[model samples]
Target chain A: MKVKPLADRVLIEPNPAEEKTAGGLFIPDTAKEKPLAGKVIAVGPGTSDVKMEVKVGDQVLYGKYAGTEITIDGKDLLIMKQGDILAII
Target chain B: MKVKPLADRVLIEPNPAEEKTAGGLFIPDTAKEKPLAGKVIAVGPGTSDVKMEVKVGDQVLYGKYAGTEITIDGKDLLIMKQGDILAII
Candidate 1:
């Protein structure tokens, strides 16, 4: 399924947080941290006049706490307003 | 310390998630969910022609995972681009 956000919203597919520690030991799900990286899949039109700094296919580093999670085609995607984005990676 | 975001960014102070369950029992910190709410403390200039829909002191509902966390005056706050906000409450 495909979803598009309106206005200044974006659709992102979160990159999973590392599952292994530096020692190469697998971390349990309960102990794993949330992922803070994702790829921009879709972006809304430029904010009125300011052109969007990010574009689809840009790999971005977002705050771990950014964006709303939505299920699309059984995959988790984030729908966040543009202001929530810290920077375009 | 006060921090003001630039451009379309916003500075927010997160509201803590509930520490207790419906049964009124305290949930362990390890199991606590991230908060999805915050209060807008500062906002950047409007996104070009789009006047800001939010303002300082407005309580907002965001995605559980939005915004970058920053420490200001020993308090944790979020700095996210405006698009990450789902709605203003």
Candidate 2:
């Protein structure tokens, strides 16, 4: 199934299993600074004011509790606003 | 003290005590549909694509955990994006 986000929303595939990478990927187990890492699966056209900065396949960092979780095609995914994304890694 | 929000951000004065009012005001006791009500104290200039729709003194509703809690002049306030606001009440 193809998912399309609307108006600044983004569809992300979380990389929770990337804990072993040290190239500034997701650091899930830390007590402080627990930003989640994910790959952008899809991006919305963005609002008139906020231009879309992220593109699909972009590796990004987001807040710990930034998005809503959903299961698509038996895979877990996250849907959030582009604002929830902190940076592209 | 004057607060000027920037880029679609709104400074809101939370009316938690409005639970006592009966005119479709904040019902702080409800578990479902618990949108917090507040008054806009400051408005941002807005980004290029998004226009500022909320003005200072506009009564609005927002999410449960929308903005960062702040204290100014001994008063508690919230600073959030205008998008966090659900509606103008």
Candidate 3:
């Protein structure tokens, strides 16, 4: 199943948190911070007042705890309003 | 010190979390959810590529973990990009 956002909202697929730094020390899951970057999967048409700024396939950075989590076709995804996004990376 | 956001960014002053609910029960700080609503204190001159949507004085909702926290002149504030805002409430 596919997810679609509504009115200034977006659907994103989160990137996994890095388990190792450039120095190559492994980090465990408990020590891992929530990921803040993702790939845009879908975008809303935006309300009459707000215009959509992101498009599908855009790599975005979002708030660490943003969005409602959902499971679609056994895949974890996030549905959030555009405002939860910080920047296109 | 006064804060001025840059390039599609915004400055927000968060509303305090509600300590009492409509039923008059008190909520402890440990149980309180992070405030997601705020009053826009300032706005950035958006980059040429992106137009600004929010203005100063607008009430907005943002992601709970959005923005960088900073203190200016003893006041706590959040500096974030326009995309971190979820809606104008």
DockQ per candidate, 2 decimals? 0.05, 0.04, 0.04
Residue A64's lDDT in candidate 1: 59
Q: What is the TM-score of chain B alone in each candidate?
A: 0.74, 0.82, 0.78
For candidate 3, lDDT tens digit of each residue in A51-89? 677789987666668899988899899999876675554
Minimal lDDT window, size 10, model 2 chain B: B18-27
> Model 3: how far is A37 from its true place, Å?
0.3
By TM-score rank, best first, the candidates go: 3, 2, 1
Q: What is the interface RMSD of candidate 3, in Å?
A: 9.5
Give the per-residue lDDT of model 2 (tens digit) for B1-89: 56555456788898966552535655558576666789998886777767899988899988867876544455767778888999998
- Superposed on all Cα atoms, the candidates' RMSDs to the truth, in angstroms, are 10.9, 11.0, 11.2
lDDT of 2 at B54: 91
lDDT of 2 by residue, A1-89 (tens): 99999999999998866541333433344233445567999999988857777789987666668899999999999999987775554
Greater-TM-score candidate between 1 and 2:
2
Position B48, candidate 3: lDDT: 56
For residue A42, model 2's alpha carbon misses the true position, in angstroms, by 0.5
